[model samples]
Target: MNTATTLPRGPGRNGAPRRGAAWLMLAGALLLSACTTPLDPRKDASLQQAAYTTDRPVVRPTRSVSSFSDSLMCMDHMLRAAQVPTTLITSKQVIDYSSRVPVAAKDMIITSLSQMSRLSNAFRYVDYEVDIVRQDTVQNLTTILLNNNLMQLQRPALYVSGAIAFVDQNVVTNRFDAGTSASRLDTGYSRNRSATVIGLEMHLGDFRTRTLIPGLDSANEVVIGSGSQGLDVAGRIGSYGVNFNVGRDYALGAGGAMRTLIDLATIELVGKWARVPYWQCLTLEQTHPDFQRQMRDWFDESGGVGQATLVQNSLIAQGYLQAGTDLLALDSPALRTALTQFQIDSLLVPTGVLDFSTYERAMRHFVTLAPDGSLQRVGWGPSGPTGSMAENKGDSTPVRTSGLVLTSTTPPPRRIDMQIENALPPGMEPTFEVGEQVFVSATVSRTSHMYCYFADPSGNVMRLTPNQVTPHSLVAANQALRLPDWLVPNPAFIMDASRPGTERVACFAAETDVLPRLPAPLQGAGLVNIPGYRTIEDIDKAFQQGVGTSGYVKSEVYWKTQPKKAQPAAAAPAAPQPAKR
Candidate 1:
């Protein structure tokens, strides 16, 4: 046995590494793994917002230009005439004399005009995408029958055409340099600038007549600019040299500039077509005081027995004259006295003669006799029906005797509550997928005549109620009418691929049947082939001009086609087993 040498250990130290240290190392690693890298504010923020901070409030850049919607609305208000059915065709080259024009410029104009049609109710746009096959002059019925592709197309009344051009362009550049001898450093800078001008011309014409509308031609110009600057520095000390450069790129390119010009031109073109007030919807020549005076004089001199009879009937309708007012007694003192009194009440000169102003005012109050012989308020138009009792041969009553009796008539005010619900399996959202069945239910608060219609993604209106099954337009008070019934899970409409956007349902109810007058197809089959009833404003305006008081409600639902799922890939064959096992 030999004596073993014992080594002296350091104070408060372990001979072997501490086990706790290993755990400490592991914990440190976990802490580091949990921590995330800090994000740079400059890189994370959007370019539009990065320039602003807490002290520097964001100031949006301003431009003295009109937007597409603004121009469309302006045109709509100015063009108060009935909507015209129109077709827009683009030429092969939308922009002429310009190399920087986008290939899609023609498509852009077409799409913008289509959108304008929807928003303004100014035009009913018909799809121009149709296939036509020329036939021989001596074609027989067999040939026609064999070519089933034949279609009966509706002709448009108006056509719009236009072109764009690049007028001029220029560019400039400047450079400068500075150096300091003591620091042995040099700095240089250069600035480049460019500008372009573009022009547009548009024309509108009557498609059938092939004649340009008097004041529908327009021209506009737009200018765009861009600039950039660069700086460079170099220094050398004891055979060692260093160089650096900094530069700023041009913010806008030629393509972007051309697009801006095209948009501005479109706004100008719409303004001209619509004859907007400040933007020149109507030209000075058309609205000159001298021309208007001449027109008034012509109309005044052209009055005849027809005009006198119209004035007499309108006065009777407005309750200014009692029944038995003689239409043939235009020169009667009683008629002249009544006309003078009406003129005074209307804040016009007390002219005993029925002048144009008095005639116009009286016409505004003209009343219509319903089929049941009840007097109803109706708007005056060129095609408005006449109310003369003589027109009704079966009725023996004279027009003067059949005048509406003046009485206090007031409609009771009532509120109508409408509710729309989706009848599908409860899920995250009440959205429908294309090809899936959609069930919708509607209810009203009171027993009334309800007219329900839906506007699809393409602005088509379809009548939902009063269909084959639910023939009656009236709904029971507080009763739910489940659409398509229980047997039909999906209504007459299906969520097709083309209709993959928000669909709106509008319902109007009244104690009396107050549905707006619809086209023949809509009233019978409840299908809207034309782009009608897209805006609620149109529906509301119709109700206001209708015979009775009513209330309305609207609801919207989203429809979309579900994205296809990706299939899983097959697993790779297991690695070959080693040789010989």
Candidate 2:
């Protein structure tokens, strides 16, 4: 060290100064490398924003297309009737300057189509991914994949094309600012409010002809709002300055608005194309001004023959007329009989004719919203025991009269939705083949005691649940209970369609355990009829009388049975050949 310090004072042939210089250069290199090296967690690298990150816990993503999920499901029957191939090829682009909206309008339409087709597979989507090749050469993913013998593609019959039409921002705006100053203090406040309108439009086209279908286009709009408020204070006194500011801003998410618009547009386009009563999905009653106006237009467009078709379809949907009957045969005995019965039940004049009054009444109460968010037929007159609209407007509890003769006397505040695979929606009277294994999926609006019954084509009714296999009758709210416990070795009752003809599955639910109140025939866990009740109506009467003015709801789904197709006998196993010894 003594020699190095002395030699560094001057440049000379001595190696001491050169060695010192080299050491300094090496030290600087080491420092620079340390600065550039990435931190290692093994060496205890510190975390940034870790505490704040957990302050607001992360949440799972939620579905946005739920407002009309029930309505979409209700339309499955109609869509299956059409059974057409539909495709969506909308551009993922925003037509207006509002870039904040997600480019997922096309996806929403596809989802809606899927929901409506869950049961019957109403529409098929063409997954024709596009591939832009050289100029004048464009190929779809289907063609490219098939060239390699990878997969098959389904040809599309109809295609949906459109865009996120527009987002009109700041359609309405208001702003206010106020400030006051006194002495060495100053204060101010401000607020800004604005509204926006988002719209989406889609058109249906014949994929084969490449022509847009007229009157099948849909354009829908939704409004969203945003606002902000702020306060500011500033002052100076005695050579000191002070300032304070506070702000709060709030806005509705645009994603929800866009999704709602897309759902509405999808319902409109598909409903128009399929010619179903689509307005039911939108929860619009016939009394609505807009509904009435639309009905007028449809009425004019659909003259006498069209009106008859509409009425016939309505009757079939309500279980009054058999499906596949001639719609143009308005004067048929079957039509008149069904119409007269419907009129008598609805408290209307039994005209036995398809008149405008009958049409209006039938359309008005085709479907109503159940408290459980499913769609069910009104099943009674507006002034029935369920009370008037005014009475139910403020009541949350479900009210209704029940019987085999009269299923629902008024709309209920709560309801249970029962579904069978490949079957029509409840109240549509779907059919089942004899010997078919039947499984029931019953979903309730709230946790309640549920009872399931099977009324054969004849007058016999058997209790299906609260049996030994699934003795517990309490079902959780919004939970689906599958009947005939497949998990158990011996389910209480096997729902084999041994009997043929029109049959019904009636499910009764209530806040309390109404099983004890039911007639002896329906109380226990067995396929055997209850001991006390002589008929199914007795059980219904017991419920109406015992659980009076309480939370009680019933869902009855009718299904017809036909002989199962005879299966060919398997070829007898060939006799084993005797080996030559």
Candidate 3:
């Protein structure tokens, strides 16, 4: 359950704070004196919020004035940028809520990570566990729900998240440097417990999601982290949905002989770190002085990380090459030489001094190769075409899917009080039937209306039964279909599209979706509403029947394709027409 070792810093937002941490020292003393039992998965448990328990049930706000707030705030901003929806816990009620529960402890870490996932609408959930090492130092766990490690892995990534550890010699067992700069460095000798956890990191998965078999998620990741000196972090995951890779390396404080134990841990994590270039792919010490710089270079050369890098490079370079000066240095006489050397193509006359243009070129390639772009299909082209052939040159992406929603060219129908009735002149009774489309501009309320009609062109009218198409979620958005042009005046009202005949499409219901729902707003020419009206006892009474369509058109209407774009140039987008309101 524990993999204690040292890992080098991967990325930094900023350092932790000072005064704000006083509470930790205060809490540390309290922790030493408190009667609370050491947290044991078997003892302390988390309260269930839904189906799972959390890590820290009770999170008492830091009592001492502190600076960690800034770190927390920065983290919040970073997560948001990642497109993760984070809900800051706003409770002022502080209570020690954690108890000894297995799920609760695990939920602490797993849950936090999972929240990251939910922010992005990614994976569904997280499951975690906790094991206590030093009892008197800290109490219960802090549950962190993790995002779907699986999903991120499928997409491939280079992630860095964790806690830090501080070791100050001047501090004795209880007198720690938790709230001061002194904590960052140690002021004493060996044999004494000189290090404490500063912050911890998270797990990263490579193409695990894309290549992993079926059932696995986080289990595929290899966790790596160390505290002030080094903290424990160990988890072996090899479930479904992933391909496995093996790697290891370690060097702490300028090659000062780090333990194999530390070496093993880093190897595990960076093996998973991945997405870094060939230079970073080498062992740590091999590129020690400038590992991170090397990594940046690799990331730049790799065309960003994920399922579509090379394809993206070719697209950005489309037609820009005179010789080797292609938009992306992806082609020509020079880059190929670098590729052969199994090294990143540096930017230089011949030395690879990659400049701003290189990065811009890489960015362009990465952007164009976005998952939904034309390059997605280039994989289907003849095996490995030459650099001269631009991939998207033969682009065949769909202009729009079968249900692609388009903006309206006209206004929509109107809402009418179908419950309202119109009074007729004496001896002039009217009946509506098939053949005449009720060219309406408004829809009526969602309910049953007394559909009354007269026999012949002048007789007593009778109310007819309604076909099933009541209260529906239609009309909420882009829902609108038209009535068949067959409805005529009849004592017995009939619905054409609702029947079975040459025109009896079928007994169906259409609420006006774009084949499927369009992901846009629906509007039209100045906006119109076609509302149906039902007669009541009097014309005035029917007028007060309310608005909205009382019935739904029953049939299947479809949209035809646009004229294919003429070749030789990108077609200009069509101007939007007002929707038929």
All candidates' lDDT scores? 0.52, 0.65, 0.26
> Model 2, residue 397: displacement in angstroms?
16
Q: Each prediction's TM-score against the native? A: 0.36, 0.44, 0.17
- For candidate 1, write residues 1-581 as lDDT tens digits: 99999989874577345656887899999888767656566775676474566557454322222223334433433432222223333322354656654446555555556445432234444445322342343344434644785644456766666676555766333445454444677667777777767676767667778777777765776666677777788888878888898888664454444444455455555656544453543322222223334334533644666457656655555544554655657678888877866665444576677666665445433333445654433322222224433334566543332223222122122334332233333345546555555544455544467766666676676677766656688765434455444325455544233456665556666655655454434455554442455654555556555643334433333444353345699999999988995
By summed lDDT, the worst window of 10 consecutive residues in model 3 runs over 86-95
Candidate 1 vs candidate 3, TM-score winner: 1
- Per-residue error for 560 in candidate 1, Å, reads 40
TM-score of 3: 0.17
- Off-target runs (Cα >4 Å) in candidate 2 are 1-56, 77-100, 133-144, 235-241, 284-581
Better of 2 and 3 by lDDT: 2
Q: Using TM-score as the measure, what is the rank order of every candidate, best first?
A: 2, 1, 3
> Comparing candidate 1 with candidate 2, which one achieves the higher lDDT?
2
Task: Give the candidate number with the greatest TM-score.
Answer: 2
- Residue 27, model 3: Cα distance from true site in angstroms: 46
Residue 63 lDDT (model 2): 32
Expressed as tens digits, the lDDT of each residue in 281-375 for candidate 2 is: 57643223234344445456557776676666666655566556665577788889888776654435777877665665455444344565433
Candidates arranged by lDDT, highest first: 2, 1, 3
